[model samples]
Target: MKRREFIGLVGGAAVWPLAAQGQQAATRVIGVLALESLPRTRASLAPAQRRLAEMGYVEGQNLAFEYRAADNQEDRLAALVGDLVQRRVSVIVAPAGPPIVAAKAATTSIPIIFFTGFDPVSSGFVASLNRPGGNATGISVLHTEVLAKRLELLRELVPRAKSVAYLRSSTNLVSDHDRIGKLQPAATALGVELLFVEASRPDDFEGAFAKIVSAKADAMLVSADAFMFSNQTALVDLAARHKIPAVYPSREFAARGGLASYGTNYPEAYRQLGDYLGRVLNGEKPENLPVQQVTTLQLVINMKTAKALGVAASPFLLARADEVIE
Candidate 1:
């Protein structure tokens, strides 16, 4: 039998049902603050829930979940986070940077576990990676740090592209000077000019693509922002209608029919978030739990997308990709 099942069996033998039920105070209530659809938010959180269950946190029994989503509205996150805080959630589980920032501001005492692509320390989420020294701690990826690498991969996909259109979100703070600024030097080294396109909401995607097409850029690089990630279906559709070869921040983009994506395995990062959640629920402080770093990167390419875009895949590049959708 599983450890949790065995423990439950053994514990029930010693304590009466009503007496044991009084221990519900020890149950963990995970408040998932998100900036996307509730269904999508819950789906993304499945990995974390599974991991927590392995550590004996069964949803609706000894564990519970509270979900609040902004539905892609950046301005709504603060209010949503406030609701979670008002509920006195045991811990705040947020994905990406924006929600975490809101959750951090909403409550200083609640433990926060995040799955972000941006640097946590630099974003002011924690004091340091090795020692968080704060109530907020979790996992981060090579997101902003790997901007140039994604550019390099895009260049490989379109060798003769002289200029590339880059998407940036006005709502995400993590896309500040520290992160987006690296693109300048990267584009310089790759001999490609960057045509920056700014889009803060769903309505702006069409206009951004229009700017890219008007600029006559060879390709596009979608920024690694939560807002953009949540609204990627529309973004992906626009890229197709505009016929722009684009490189994305995660494998989900490629799976959704984008040309290419190079970045962290999000599910694994969420699993790490689960690991941290388990630790915090088990009486460990967030300050003592060092922030986990996402090291597993996936290079994903869709041959179908490549064929439709008329971009020939180099044998070397194809071989280097961790996954290719034929």
Candidate 2:
């Protein structure tokens, strides 16, 4: 090689390692705790990853994940949070209220970005939505706040739905109280009798459905809870087997062939959560970042499920749906 070329090559080689080292140093590890099953969690996070990429975060290049899923097991959350805490990830992103609550209990100093269904202040996850005033902050979807809307949709779907069944997990009593308190008045106003059923685990699903059948519920409204999301398939299947019309709080349920669903766009909420995570990684304090409320309510209808249940989706309802799965 020529002498000048040899010197140039040596200088280039010397600079490469420094650049790689700096890139490695800039990389951040994000810990994720999901209360839903792993497959659902991954599916929900696809948009979040894309949003992060759009914001200049590339996994394995500058961002890393330490992911843990509860797989419908609420008891596993604490251990998962402990593992993430031990790893000392740059930020913890928890989707769903249970895992977020567990993460909050596990650490007060770790920066946590959570995607929740209820108000953060009422849930005690944060001091306030405007200013978190603590280490935890993220998005809140109006799950409990929209119980009346879900009931309205159910009533619309089944015009003769004089008896409506409400299903939720038994583990979160506080959420149950909040949900029931909101649902009762709406049920009365709609002239529908509400039958409440609780399922703490997957095994309890069958029994809960049996109770709904016995109660002769014309339709069902499933609460927006992590356990319910985790067991969505079973719930949808059971509702079909019993030939009952059901409305869920997430689009995933309708996509999975449930009768209908109405609520905030959760994947969009997760995308916002990813954005907040990136901001925290860039040195924004969780306390300074206001908790975000997802406002884009989506209505999803499954024509196939409706037809199978012998229910007609009116032209008006179909036109109003954000998405209709055939």
Candidate 3:
């Protein structure tokens, strides 16, 4: 994609028109609280806006968005959500796990929409999936359950891999620990030793890669989280520098030259979120709208990255992938 085209696709176009138009008398403003920076979070928002536009809510026309990015700082989320709540936004849209948690805590009266990988009910974000029973509901990607399958795919791609390094954000300790717990047995069953690496910031990436190399990990499976996703380019470069085949959770990784990715279609989920937001704005209650589960999944492989790592792409995997980067 051309630079301008990519920017528009990712919702990075200038917001001059949006700001100039201000909030219409009947237009409702939706607060978007993202856990990462604008550039990193744009990918998740583009599809949602497109979906909303299709549902008759045009930016600067019928709908206005109040966006705030925490830039991966957990400490700042509560304050950000509080500002949005004070602004009296018609609804709140949280892109990552923590932002959703913060939004839920910030207000109970305003409807909140979320795109999360964690179990809403288990995480205490909702009463149940079928009926959220509150002013919150959106979509679930079911990321935890896919741990086994991700490991299986990594092993399938690198059969002789004796060790696998798992990278996660150290800041989100609870989720990080839970993810490792879920993947440990699966790694053992596949006869692969699992090495854990925690890096909470961009500056920690080089050291983390050094640790991965020292641990003698033959491949890596990156844990899915907002922090990790924020440093996608850096992570992809480090994996390539170490010549270690790695798998990620989203196609954006593969698009940026990661070896492979297997997970829910994130853009589709965002589009669904937009549709649901439209419904909420049009006299529908969040509790009444059942939390939707992402049914479509995508597998993406980058042949160039595969070759750079000296690993040949398996024909079976290539055939099954939804997209391949040559």
Candidate 4:
């Protein structure tokens, strides 16, 4: 038997028939705080549930979950996280930067597992990757440094493009600033001009697309964030209506008919988070677990979107893509 199973068996032997002793029952609860209500965020929660089940924790038995979403409103996050803390959850799982920030501010005693794209050290989320030294610990997708490579690929796919419009969320200003600082120097070296458009809210997408058109950008790149991911369909439709080729940071964007996307697989990251949570629940400290970095990045292209934009995806780019939605 595994260590946890052995301990459970031995403990149960000593505390046999606790009900006979009239002892009250206790259940462990985990709280999940998501930045927005989106399919991708919902999809990520399943693997975590599955992992917990494998570790002998069953929902409605000894394990329970409290799920809350900000519904794409940045202002609602603090309230939602506070609600979870007030409920006194044993552990909290936060996906995306904003929700994680809110959870960190809400409690220091409860363990927090986060999935973020920014560098946790630079963002001050932790002391170090190897030694988080606090209740917060999980995975970092390390997105800031990859901006140049993503831009290079966009340039490769559209060699004649002189100007590129970059869409970013105003709420994630820290990430946006870091991305621009890294992207501009590489863009200059490639002789390409980068125009930034801010889409702080869903209503801003239409205006952002119009700005892209006015800038006469040959293509566009969207910075990764939960807000953008949540409104992906609207962005895809807008790009299609405007006939502007675009690149995104997740395959889900391309799957929804965006031109192309390149980034780490998000669902797999959640699965890893589940494993880490299991360790923590089994008496391991968060500080002892090193923060994970995603190594598998996927390249995806949508043939239909490319055709609609009147651009043929180069054979070289197509060959390198992990998935091609036709």
C-alpha lDDT score of every prediction, in listed order: 0.87, 0.88, 0.86, 0.84
Please provide, for model 3 over 146-227, each residue's C-alpha lDDT reduced to its tens digit, 9 standing for 90 to 100.
8778899998889989999988776443554566788988987899898888888788999999999988898999988888
Of the candidates numbered 1 and 2, which has the greater lDDT value?
2
- Model 1, C-alpha of 261: deviation from truth (Å): 0.6
Instruction: Give the 10-residue window scoring lowest on summed lDDT in candidate 4.
Output: 19-28
- Count: clashes, candidate 1: 0
User: What's each prediction's clash count?
Assistant: 0, 0, 0, 0
lDDT score at residue 310, model 2, on the 0-100 scale: 87
Question: What's the distance in Å from true for residue 290, model 2?
Answer: 0.7
Top TM-score prediction, candidate number? 1
**Estimated TM-score for each candidate:** 0.91, 0.90, 0.90, 0.89
For model 4 the local lDDT of residue 47 reads: 82
lDDT (10s digit) by residue, model 4, range 35-132: 87845566777887788788887778777878898887878888988999999887889888888889989999888999888778877778999899
Task: State the lDDT at 81 in candidate 2.
Answer: 93
> Which candidate wins on lDDT?
2
Model 3, residue 129: C-alpha shift (Å): 0.2
Q: What digit string (tens of lDDT, one per residue) describes model 2 on residues 1-326?
A: 99999999999999999999999788899898998877888887788888888889989889988889988788899999999999888988888888888999999888999887766787788888898888999988888888899999999989999999889886553655777898899999999999988897899999999999988889999988888888888999999999999999989899888999999887778888888887888899999999888889999999999999988989999999999998
Over 4 Å off, model 3: 1-23, 171-178
TM-score of 3: 0.90
Q: Please write out the lDDT profile of model 1 over residues 214-321, one tens digit for every residue.
A: 999999999887777878789888899889999999998999999999998988888778888988888899999888888889999999999999999999999999
